[model samples]
Target: MNITFPHLGNTYIAAKVLFEGLGVDYTIPPLSSKKTLEIGCLYSPDDVCLPFKIMIGNYVESIQRGADTVLITGSCGPCRFGEYCELQKKILLSLDKDIKFIVIDEPAKIGIREFLNRLSMVAKDSKLSKAKKIKALSMAVKTINLIDNIEKECRFFAGFEKNKGEFARLLKTVKLEAIEAKGAEKTLKVLEEHYEKLKKIEIDNFKNPIKIGIIGEIYTIIDPLSNMYIEDILMNLGVSTRRTLYPSWWVKNTVLSGLKINFSKIYKESKEYLGLCIGGHARECIGEAILNYKHGFDGLIQIFPVGCMPEIVSKAILPDIERRYGIPILSLVVDEMTGEAGYYTRVEAFLDLIEGRKKLCI
Candidate 1:
């Protein structure tokens, strides 16, 4: 089966590496864009959250490009994300698109045997031996972690860079070039060279730029197109930003959480506010806000698409966190109709507020 999946930041890079290393055919849908969103909205119900719509767009685009199977992860939480696969399948079928869906869900929900059965659909397509298949999976994880690290480094160093735009330029260049590498091994090599390069980027030691922690729905925070590249915007404004959620973190949490052995720190921090995993990343979002505040971030920006139930709950609880910690927090809700100008205005205003607060403290 020719496989395709939704784009989640640097996830496409790792997925490409994994599928190719397995000797399976796959199609990388063009990056998420206005056209993708438009297609998604056209098919999705009006009330579904933005992510579902954008994902639909990705699948449609991939289908047109000759993908017959759509590979997606599933969650059995109270969050709407769990429902995405079922709805997407129906939508595709309604549109007369004959697509196969392989949803990789938790073993508990789908049963361990069923989980393996679902995974085998893709795994069995590979010509490689079982040992090599396992190796390929490991390489894909490493690739994701390395790319996430590079992005984190770039965002944190952007504020202190000796030359304006240097960090951003290097980050953009690395991502673009890494994806073009011939194979998983070459991609890893490219990332390693750039990881060292990122360390050596010139930074002014004394510049204490505004630092903000991004906390919100996992998909919105990680995917640039979903949030209108908010992290890039923060970097351009010379602000250092940190986000705790990444594909690597998600993978780890998903695998181990079923064993009740995941997110010790997040659980500890969020206990006072949201102790339960009420679906989505609401608990994590609440925990992250407090964690960033304790770590002395200037402020926090909480972003999620409109109609996200878990984030809506977190939004209600965040003001209390802001008051308790005395840190400013801005909640930005986005959807297909979000205007770029208004979004940028609010973002800039939030930055200004943080800067003003910093000046007052000084």
Candidate 2:
């Protein structure tokens, strides 16, 4: 049976490796694009969060390419992500798309037990084969996850080195090697190779690496509709950004702690890092930015859904943060109508103002 997973950057990359190792074939969804968004926006409610639109588009396009199944890793939270599988299924069925969805629920802390179950589902037809597959794939997954983490960590500080593309290239190579290799030692070897190669580069052109702290709803941060790929936008505009949240942290800290109502978790890496706000996931945006500012970020950007209630609440107090920190800030609120050109235009303008000050100090 052919299987497929959505194009969620590293998630599917890791899944493709893990699943493929089990003797199952899987295809990743196509890279997300404008036409995908157009299709998604056509079927979605105008006011729903942007992630829903982008993911719907991902599914719509994926099924057209003979993709028989869609993979969904489950979530339990106040965030709308918890219902993505059910909602996406409803949308696909309403459109009469004959796609099948394979929803994979998160494994509990039983560690190896949870992994064993996942392995059995996708690979190993017989009991004996399953046992062997589990041992091999588990080792590979640990290696893959490690390489992925290293690459992600490298992204954090890549700005400190010149030719950020060089680091990006090495990261990709290391990740692919980890996925295809048989042993954890192979993973370690690839990582060491990349590290050695990077040390050779002079990297003297490393920019000032102004720190820009980003905070917002999970959708806006990851989903292009909400932020128009703001992270990339920041990097191109020469702003080295620090984002407080990631899926690992989301799963490890927020999800595992039992879904608390009314936003109680004090996110360690977020801009606010801890605090409250109202509307549009603004509380998170505001809190993350405040913490980031105190931590010495040169600037902060709060991204959120156009109508996100909590973010709307946070925006009200953003001026107070600006006043308190004496640092530059640019908040980008997004919806379907927000265009990429317009977003970058604003970012360029912000970068000009900030970079101008940097030059003045010299």
Candidate 3:
């Protein structure tokens, strides 16, 4: 079956690894782009968060490219993510398309068990070499995870803009190179070689750096469009940045939440987010404010769709966080209407204030 997946940051890479490893027929919808966002926006309710648009784009793109099954994960929560796969399913059907979708409910940051099921789904009880497929996928996931870590670091270090977009491009290229190498040992060697090359590229972390925390709806925080390419804007301004949420965290929350366990851990992960239903990812975002203040971050950037209810709820409560924490948060609401000029301007102002303060500290 021709399979499809969305770009929820790392999962995009993981899905790629899964398909490649299993030797299954699949394709990645193009990376989240303006057109992708536009497709998502056109089909989705204006009130929902930007992630909806991103998910739709992947589904639509995949279907157009002759994809049969779209591999989606199930969500359970106040976060609304629990229903995303279902909602996207209806949306696709409404569009009058014939698409087969598999919603895997595997709960873990590793998603090892979940994705393996997809491979097995293709296998369909065929005694034909189950072990080989498992081994290949396992190795692929390991290499991909390693490669993802490097990409994250490169993206983080590339947060400083001394080298142009070279490092970020190299990071993606190296990941693709690893995927193509199709062997664990070759992937490792390529990683080492690239690491050496990237290290030699000069980047001054201290150059007018504005340490900032990215918060808000998960998709916008990770997917560039939903956030208006906020990270690139920050990098160009020489701001040191960190994304607060990732699939790993979500996977952990899913497993623990599924077991109805780890209340303390969840509360500790984001005290601001306690007492929220599964869909209420907003409260968790507030916890980021506290985390940032504790870690000496200069400012915070909150991203969400224009009418995202959960985030609007969080926004209502943010002044208290801003006041209590004494850190400025630049909350940028995203929609199709969000333009580059305004986003850059607000980001520039926020970075300027943070930089000015940093210089004063010295």
Candidate 4:
């Protein structure tokens, strides 16, 4: 099984660690770029969401390098994501590309036995003993959590760094080094070393900076290409940002959800506005808006792909939260046709508004 999967932020890094540790033949698609988006647009339905098109590009790129199996998580919800794997499989097959898909869905949805069976398919090629395989899984989990923590710190601290661009540079360097490192162990070491370096960077806690919370569709918010690297843009502007969704957070949430346990306090906060899932992360978006407001965020930016139903709903509800708490919220919708100049202009304007609001308080 020459496995390949769609990129979800830094999830690709952890996937590399997992596949390398398993000693399985796998291919990591080149990072998402304009070329990737263009290719995806060429083949995908014009109306499909942005993420679906980008994923098609990722699969085609990997297939050129000899990947025959695709690994993706499944969702059995009202959201269109649940239909992605099936539609994507058909799309590829229609083009006469022979490929297989292994979808790892929640144990509660697909049942625990089926979940393990699907997972076993990926490791069946590995010669490692059962214990070693388990160890590899553990290592991958640790790698993801460690990297996410590192990224979170870098983003939040970017606003306070005494040396401009220090956090951004360190973040880029660490990701490059970690990806270049051979095995999971070495990758973990690279992260650990840089984390120590991160602590040594000078930051001024007294320097108050604009802080924003990012909320909206999971894929668009987490994947850099999808959101046009909004987080990086914020870092460059010396703005502190926070978001509740990360690949690591998703992993824990999925597990807790399967166990019928509520893992996030955000859900409780959102209940007053949006009481049900309504598909996608709309509930979480509303919840995060309230949570960020209570935590004293200067503003909130909600990003989602164009035509996304759930976020369209959240966009409407956000005004209520803004009025109720006097927090500013900006909603940006993106698709293949979105212009870079216009998008950046809106972001900059939002920042200007936040700064003006902050000055008024002082």
User: How many Å off is the CA of 110 in candidate 3?
Assistant: 19
Q: lDDT scores for all predictions?
A: 0.91, 0.63, 0.71, 0.92
Model 1, span 1-362: residue lDDT tens: 89999998889989988987898999999999999999999999999999999999999999999999999999888888998999999999887657889999888898999998998898778888989998999999999999999998899889999989989998999989888998889988898999998888898999999999999999989988989999998999899999989998898887788786764688799999987879999999998998898898999999999999999999999999988889999999999999999999999998888888899893
Winner of 1 and 4 under lDDT: 4
Candidate 4: which stretches are off by over 4 Å? none
3 or 4, greater by TM-score:
4
- For candidate 1, list the clashing residue pairs, or say none: none
Provide the clash count, candidate 3. 12
Writing each residue's lDDT as its tens digit, candidate 2 over 129-241 gives: 65666764664455444544654555555566666566556766765675566533554566567666656754555356767777777656755445776765555544567
Candidate 3's residue-wise lDDT over 53-137, tens digit each? 7789878887788787777776545566767877788888888567777877645533768766664675453343768767766
- Candidate 4, run of 10 with poorest lDDT: 91-100
Q: Among these predicted structures, which one has the highest lDDT?
A: 4
Under the 3 Å rule for N, CA and C atoms, how many clashes does model 1 have? 0
Name the lDDT of candidate 2: 0.63
Q: Give residue 270's lDDT in candidate 2 (0 to 100).
A: 37
